[model samples]
Target: MALQIISVVLFTVFFSEALTLMCYNCNTTTECTQANCSSSCSSMTNHNGNNITFVKKCADSAWCFNSSINLGLIWMSSQCCSSNLCNNATVSENGLSCYTCNDKDCTNRLKCKGGEDHCITATGESLQNTVKGCASKNICDNITLLNNTLPQQHLSSSCCRGNLCNNAQKMTQGPVLLLVPILSLLFYILGLF
Candidate 1:
């Protein structure tokens, strides 16, 4: 009975170890520590000019993919691997250039990296601030779909292809667009009188 119990315990330990994936986990400049999970390991990196930030952790394979956001002076990306302890830091090169905004100035150029293929211009909820950058088609599509479903859009965004296509002035509808219908109605009422 003693030998049988020992064999059972050993089998359980080996089986559990085989089922778990060990990954490196860390953030920014921190040293990586081993972490266990059932999914793949990921390494995410952000490059802002000369500065670089790196993160490593275990993540689901379904959510892992190479993606990037380019903000002229800054860029970010994420990568994933399935093998144990395979989350090595890696930086992807930007292939396209686009206009980006900083404060009120939208003249700066940004390199679009990873899977980004579109130039994006977005306005905040308050409409007082605008941001321009490079984004993946997935991000642009989801933003468009979400905006179309809202009765009153809290955020407005536009996406275009080719370099510097987003350089055009703010794309959000202004108060002037709202005044058109009101002005037309007033003209019809006055003409009737």
Candidate 2:
């Protein structure tokens, strides 16, 4: 009986599996969820020249990419790995540079991280604040759709290739002065679904 008990205890200890991992979940209120994930990680990017990050615990075989979801016009860049609470850190940088400023002239410099290869410039009718930053090509491609998706006021976006292409100043009164794609993406959250 003693030997049997020992064997049973050993088996239970060896076969017991961890229930779940703690993950930082984004919500209106700060919350955490026990998730079945081998890794926890975050997605990071410059939005209107400011860094935006989202954290989530990820399953196995996860990879990273900057992708746009048309349903809610959700643009996401996610990086995943296989470690507990691994998503807590900032995503790796992608070595791209662009001029950046928010609610002001584009005088500040921004570091483009992840899959953001295109530089974006934007101005809105109501706010009249010029926003500049780096973005994925998809966000730059469908400016009309983006505007329509988040329409309370008129917004405009211009996307350009090459480093620091958005560094130049524009005379707002002239159409000929506007260059590249401007991303007024935050007219409000697009596709809030």
Residue range 1-193, candidate 2, lDDT tens digits: 9999999998887665463444555532356565554444443322222334344545344334333211011234444444566555554457777776532345556677655778876666755455566776655666767667546547676778888887755324323122213222332233111
User: Where does candidate 1 have its weakest 10-residue lDDT segment?
Assistant: 184-193
Query: Which has the greatest TM-score?
Result: 1
Please identify model 2 stretches exceeding 4 Å from their true place: 1-34, 37-54, 58-89, 150-152, 170-193
lDDT of each: 0.66, 0.51
Per-residue lDDT tens digits for candidate 1, residues 52-133, read: 7778888888767655556665555566788889887545555777787765667777777767889977664544556678
Candidate 2: clashing pairs of residues: 40-87, 41-87, 121-182, 157-181, 157-182, 157-183, 158-180, 158-181, 158-182, 159-181
